[model samples]
Target: MEPLNYLASFIQSAETGSFSAAARRLGLTPAAVSKNVARLEASLGLRLFQRSTRSLTLTSGGERFLHQVGGAFSTVQEAIAGVAKDDGQPAGVLKVGMALAFGREHLLPLLDDFLLRYPGVLPDWHFDNHPVDLVGGGFDAAIGGGIVLSPGVIARELLRTDLLVVASPEYMKGRAMPDHPTELARFDGIVRRSASTGRAKVWTLRHDDGDEGQALLRPRVIFDDPEAMAYAAMRGIGVALLPMPHAARWLKSGALLRLLPRWRGEAGTVSIYYPSKKMLPAKTRAFVDHVVEHFRRPEVAAVFDSGRYR
Candidate 1:
């Protein structure tokens, strides 16, 4: 078998975590998949994986090999697809990474439209609450809220979302509302620990009058998961700063109320980012345009406005 085919089989096996699963995907028998892996391992003289009756795990050597060879294989696939394109229709697998909340709230609805518009494309989606290195992971595109972009990646703003300080209506009932950023010190705060850097995100707020003053409030309760933090806020645990989309439904139902609305905190831009490449495939280009158009709708804008968490 060709080196590329062997590499592909190895990658499939590693990703699926079993020879049978990989064989099913590759249209080969389980024994054939096992033979390919064994041959490849012998040729390289390295133990790629550790296997047992119940589980399979990548060895240190296998991990490194996958990272290097998987990236190369993706590049080859992209090149082949680029040459194979005709009549403005692109054909290839487009891997996308997105934040969990955004993917469910906004992206899920638009996916069908994108696929219908581009029938030649196959999509693989990976969702996480934290940022990921798109190019390193062979992702064609990423949709996320934060503005942080890794080197060699390009970002286009899809929409602007304002951060908000919110608390359960029960929590806000009789207590005096904080009129300024400084007053936030008196309220209990919930913090989202950064999954990328493993640091708690400090809540930053600013006055609306174009004043330069800002407040960085520390959290009384710090959690790694944003959904959990939002749940705690719903239960009236403390005031929390959250993305507008995540906090919107609760705010609309009166379960949570925005605090200090007049004080417009820092505005964050939701953007689609991709690796800066010489030629973007037609499918990727089409999907990017589709997302931009979707977010531009007035009704979509209203959702974020209603859920404004500042």
Candidate 2:
């Protein structure tokens, strides 16, 4: 096999953490996969992986090689697709990283539609609340909210999400609703630990009267998961600050009610981020355009109407 093929086999083995799995994926035998990796490691004069009877793990050198070589592989794939007459059809594995809550509520439902439109494409999605290193993890793209800090990554804004102060009607049945940000301190706040920042999200409210205040809420119950936080808020546990869409269904059902509506904070933009390369694969570009166009629909925008609060 060629050097590039050996490198590709090595990457596949590292990603799947098993020679057998890589072999199945690449249509090679387990022995062939092991031999290719071993030869590649010898050519580079380094141990790329630490293997045992039960598992395999990448060495530091292996990790670095995967990151650098993955980009090179992506470039080669793009070049081949560009020159090929069948460039109109995108076919390849496209890995994506995104927030768990957002992906579940938004992206998951649209996945079937995407696959139907691009039947030749295969998608591998990794959903987590924490920030992901796309290039290191070999992700083709990531959907994220808030500020993106990675260098050499390009970001395109998709939509804006507004923060809402909401509580279950049962929680507010006897207690008075907070009319301003200052009053929020008296309420039992349900806080969600942010996966990206690794801290509890601080609630910031700006009133229509030109008054702005921020509060570092200590939750009566702290949930690392957004879905759990939404559930707790629905059960009348306490006031929760969340994106509008997460609380929308409950709000419409009268299970949760918005508080201090005029004091809601500024909108945060959701965006798709990827490597800042001159040429992106047609599959990735198509996915980005699909997501952007979906969000631009009037019905979708109404679900998380950032302008409603402002």
Candidate 3:
């Protein structure tokens, strides 16, 4: 039996936490994956996994071995792929995770272009509002904001926009325009809450003179989605401090008015994140390059600039 086959099976099973899942990922039967792992254990004279009917756990020895070589085979596969691709094109599944709104609003439209460019590669994407564990979830890359950087993860900033206070003309009607951030209390405030944490967010405004201020008003309406908050602001619900990307069209079309424009709210970034693999797979590498290039394009670059909000 080929040792590499068992090694691949072992790594896949360990990653998925189930032999059946590993089998699905590797295109083998569950029995075959179990048999391969058993053969590996016998060859190494060490039990790697603590298996049970309900769950699977890695023994201490298994953990140590995974730490050493969990990524090694992927690197080897990349080298072989590189050699093969010298005469052909890279082709495979590229799994990605992205935020729900941003993915639908910004990324989905660009898929046709990407597929046209890399016909051999397949795009498999998961869209969600919460952060995803890239490696543990078996994703090749993810695009989202406010993701906590994990050990094997790396992030490249795609765009960062300044947050601004905005409201519809109707919402601002008959309300006095406040000169300072403190005077914002005279109007109704619509604030956004974190979807993951369920905690309401407060705006920290920065002045040009190097002083900062936090919004003192309590939110009359709370939203977990940015689009909803933006729409509410457009419908004269209240003032919202939102990223410029969400309000760009409204602000540009005079649908929304930028209030206290000089006092910008908090800045946030959207980033592309991937595992810090020694030899990134061709599919992963291609998607990352394409996305980075996509953001770097002249048309896309201008809208994401924080300066536009001011």
Candidate 4:
């Protein structure tokens, strides 16, 4: 067997944690897998795995090696699969990372249309609130705001993230409606704190008439998620500053009312992140094009634009 075959055996053994399991995945006998792994270790002069009667675990060297090669190997497999198909059609798992509420509300709705265009692409998506390491996590792409672009990563801007002050009508029954942003401190506030910085988010509200004010909200409840803040506001807990995309549905259904219609909190843009544009995978390219086109639609763009809501 060649060195590539030995590396494959070693990788499979590390992932599956047993020679028998690796053999099953590779369609080889346990002895063959073990022998290939041994050959790999001998060639590198490194002890890769610590084996026992009932356990198989990677050493420090093995962990570092796997970390370096795992994503590269997966890309190679994807390329091979893409080539093996007819006419170089995109075929394979398209791994993506995105925020949960954002993905469901905006992106997932386009899945049917995307699949119709590229039937061979299977979306393997991860939804979390935090940023994901694109290369180390083996993700084809990620979508959200405030993601730091690493050396080899590229981002395509989708739209500006606009936040609005909102609350349930029930919460405002007897309270005085504030005419200025400064009076927002009088209301109970449901605010979001940054998970990374451990500081509460403060937005400077701007109006079309060139007036500006800082929303000094008194925090009655604090959450780490914008969606949670929206939910709390809907239950009449307090006023929440929320992204228009997450608050649109509830606001339309009259479950929540927009406050301070003249002012908006301008956060940074939301974008899609992928590896360098050079030699990008066909599936990822197709997905990125679809997303960019979708957001360009007037109706979809209006939903996220604070100016329209105001």
| Predicted structure with the largest lDDT when compared to the true one | 4
| lDDT per residue (tens digit) for residues 1-310 in model 3 | 2788899899878877889877865778989999999999999999999999999889999999989887777787667778777346657888899977788878888899888978888888998878887766667899988777866578998888778888999977888877777778877888888766788877788877877887755578988878888899999888888887787878888889988878887657889999766647777887898898898898898876556655
- Each candidate's number of clashing pairs is 4, 0, 0, 0
In angstroms, give how far residue 34 of model 2 lies from its true place: 17
Ranking by lDDT: 4, 3, 2, 1
Model 1 agreement with the true structure over 1-310: per-residue lDDT tens digits: 3776677679878876778766765667878888888889999999998989887779999999988887677688667766778766866688888988779877999988888888888988998977765654557799886636765568988777667778898888889987777777788888777766788776566556665434455578988766677889999889887777677877788888888776555547779997555436678887888888888888888888833444
Q: By the TM-score metric, which is better: model 2 or model 3?
A: 3
Worst 10 residues of 4 by lDDT: 77-86
Local accuracy of candidate 4 as per-residue lDDT tens digits, 46-158: 99999999999999999999888877876776666576775777767899999999998889999999999899899999999998877546578999987888656899999
lDDT per residue as tens, model 2, 163-236 = 78888878888897666677788888898776667777786777777888885454798788766778998887
On lDDT, the stronger of 2 and 4 is 4
lDDT score, candidate 3, position 146? 79
lDDT of each model, Cα atoms only? Answer: 0.76, 0.79, 0.82, 0.85
Between candidates 1 and 2, the lDDT winner: 2
What C-alpha lDDT does candidate 2 achieve relative to the native structure?
A: 0.79
TM-scores of the candidates in the order shown? 0.67, 0.72, 0.84, 0.75
Tell me the deviation in Å of residue 229 in model 4. 0.8
